[model samples]
Target: MKRPVPRIDLFDVRPDDERAFVFAQDLRIIEARLFSSAEPQTSTTLRPHLSAKADVGALMEALQRDYAPRGVNLLRVAGGWMLCTAPDLAPVLNEQAPEQRKLSRAAVEVLAIIAYHQPVTRAEIEDIRGVSTSKGTLDVLLETGWIRLRGRRRTPGRPVTYGTTPAFLVQFGLDSVQDLPGLDELKGAGLLDGRIPAGFSIPLPSDDPQLHEDEEPVEPEPLDFTLSPLPTADEDEN
Candidate 1:
């Protein structure tokens, strides 16, 4: 004899019609988890409490709405969500503790070069700067979480190319690399001389985060090679 088929009620309502109540309870659970944790939580980390059909995006939206006017606001940071102080409160908070540890001139220059001419190799940076760049300068930018190794050039020796990170866009208040100051803006800001050669221009920067036609995918930096000094301008000439 054939076994009877089990019936599954996809829309079955629970007692007291408590589905909405259950969602609200789940929202509270998520809120408590976020509040108690010191670090930002990703959806994957918070999914255990939610049913398979639960909409994590909707829950996050609701939480964001609820916290919009509060002292703490939900913010997307470094590709994850975190609760952060309101922008209006920043000035008051900053007054209590001033910023220290400014970037050195070399570090600043290196950062600027990487931001503007990204996916650039060390040799390209040196060529633009008219001086040799120190590995320490690159290290400082890396430590700041502003720039990252993108890939290696397809040319000889496959030197690693560098590019600005998403953190760089967040820190600089830029929506995209294309929003970087152009020649006209630079001239207006007095960063560049008003009098310049005809057809002088800044190349439009790309933030595509993909290896270009001339680039090979990045390989892991060798453990022993990372500490070694990068080639200087003189070394490049030789």
Candidate 2:
């Protein structure tokens, strides 16, 4: 359901450099909380006050126009302003954090396609992957809020199309699809193969035997084919 944008105290942004990033991150946390809220309150410090009376437009200008030039990227979504680094610099952080776990090749490709040609259909995805995706695969991404439906495509059947979610960018430390690694970069890094790193398959644990001990055994049906003639109407009735 659509809700009112909580008034954020725009003036709360501290006058500092490194703290800008912290404030930017904190601003998103506040927005996420506000977006998910029902009875939005004004008592919240960061909801929507700015410079003792500056309007939101002026605040955005101050944040996105001026501060962003100094290396911040302010994005307005869901009636809230979020502070983050420009998409241009996202790769630098990812490069620096080499220890961060990489997603499976299949998952990465799925994400990449969604990032590039968003609102794409499952058929299109299968064509791109050259293999049918498990039904649960997309479910996993959706459950993690990495992707979401972007309405249906106006095709023959109007299948629901998929697109990346904001959480996806946050998780990857990216500002947008524009921050995605270039084709040449992926190729140079030998990542085109899209192989998942070793041993990520999580095998399920066995259920408790106690739960099934009293359950009925499923009997395997015996084959009864002996070149029998098709049942006549009389025999069928009998």
Candidate 3:
């Protein structure tokens, strides 16, 4: 008879060092899942595949550390984590994507006001901008899916309030509306005048999806807008 083959139970005879190796293997699996996913993965969605003792936070931290210096980085977006190219690579990647149309100056101003002071009404936006807002301006923003009607204010006339959408956050690369640059940051970027106004401050923006106590749900309304004819060459000349 052949010499009895030495029987070794890998699981039963595993060394203490193997525990760390197994933990690392688990991290690799998590990393692969996140890397391969098209959308961000939440901890709850990723936990089932992990052992009971596996710490999701620690695994995510490890993956973040590993990719920190790489072109791709793990980012938290909309309450979940996803892999994204580093900010430094934006210019290069932007060239690969289609040319994005820029918002008009008026639209930009209206959007900024709405973002910073949301649950704001058309009248409020006009007041802040010191001019009357054309219905077409709001229509353009609504069509773009950036701003949305929040609810009607509980005051007189009960005008519809507007707020920024998640699409706005994503378009601006913001994780939340709270991440908007503060007044000081705006001044540093030369976006705000450095005038010395005592107690001047920026309002904190909230992304709360629910209607506030002062707001009422919007009621379905028939569209009342009509398009005007484009200006002809003769009209343009005049």
Candidate 4:
């Protein structure tokens, strides 16, 4: 008779150890998903890639714990999960300036106004800024993917309205538009004067993508907005 194969019990493993191994595998899957994605990943989007019985929440928590001491961290951003370098490491990494188109001051102001007051018309933006807003400025912002044409206002001209995009939230590392600095925080940051009118206040920003009661959906083939070439660095307005 052939030498009896060495008897081995495959089921002799401890239940806790087996569970731990499964947990570690699931954590790796979650980690890989986060690493491979260019944008933040929501649990719903990540569920299909994991084992049927995997607990995504627990796995994410465990992965977060594992990375707590690392140079990078798993953080929530733009209503999803993303791996970001720890804040403390920013100074060390700031020397390498990434090449990117710089936004003009006008574009920055327009962007801020859109973030604070969404579904606003071009006229409304100009009114709030107390100056004319150039189509070129709006075009620069649109090209940045930070703002979008939300809809058309129901008023006389039925002008197109603007709102912040999810890209804006991600760029700013915010979970929502409401996470933007409030009046108190602005004052603390010296972005506002200490002496302000009692009635002056910041508008509560909303990123809701729905058309408001006074707004209508944009046409399927909306009219193309005419955009002028962006100004060169030296020509950009202060």
Which predicted model would earn the best TM-score? 4
Error in Å for residue 49 of model 3: 5.0
Residue lDDT tens for model 4, 97-191: 58688898888989999999897889999998999999999998998899999999988878999999989988888989999999999999998
Q: Against the unseen true structure, what C-alpha lDDT does each candidate score?
A: 0.78, 0.56, 0.83, 0.84
Tens-place lDDT per residue, model 3, 1-238, is 5332232333354446665655676676787888788756878888888877777777777777778999999887756688889999988888799877878899999999999999899999999889999999999999998999999999999999999987787666677899999998999999988684798889999979999999999998868997899999999999
Q: Between 2 and 4, whose lDDT is larger? A: 4
Off by over 4 Å in 2: 1-47, 52-104, 193-238
Root-mean-square deviation of every model: 12.5, 17.4, 12.9, 13.2
Which stretches in model 1 have alpha-carbon errors above 4 Å?
1-17, 36-45, 95-99, 128-131, 165-210, 217-238
Instruction: Please identify which of the two predictions, 3 or 4, would achieve the higher lDDT against the true structure.
Output: 4
What TM-scores do the predictions have? 0.63, 0.44, 0.75, 0.82
Leading candidate by lDDT:
4
Model 3's C-alpha root-mean-square deviation from the true structure amounts to 12.9
Clashing pairs in model 2? 7-47, 7-48, 8-46, 8-47, 8-48, 8-49, 9-46, 9-48, 9-49, 10-49
Better of 2 and 4 by TM-score: 4
* lDDT at residue 237 of model 1 (Cα atoms): 100
* Candidate 3 wrongly placed segments (more than 4 Å): 1-33, 36-39, 48-50, 196-198, 222-238
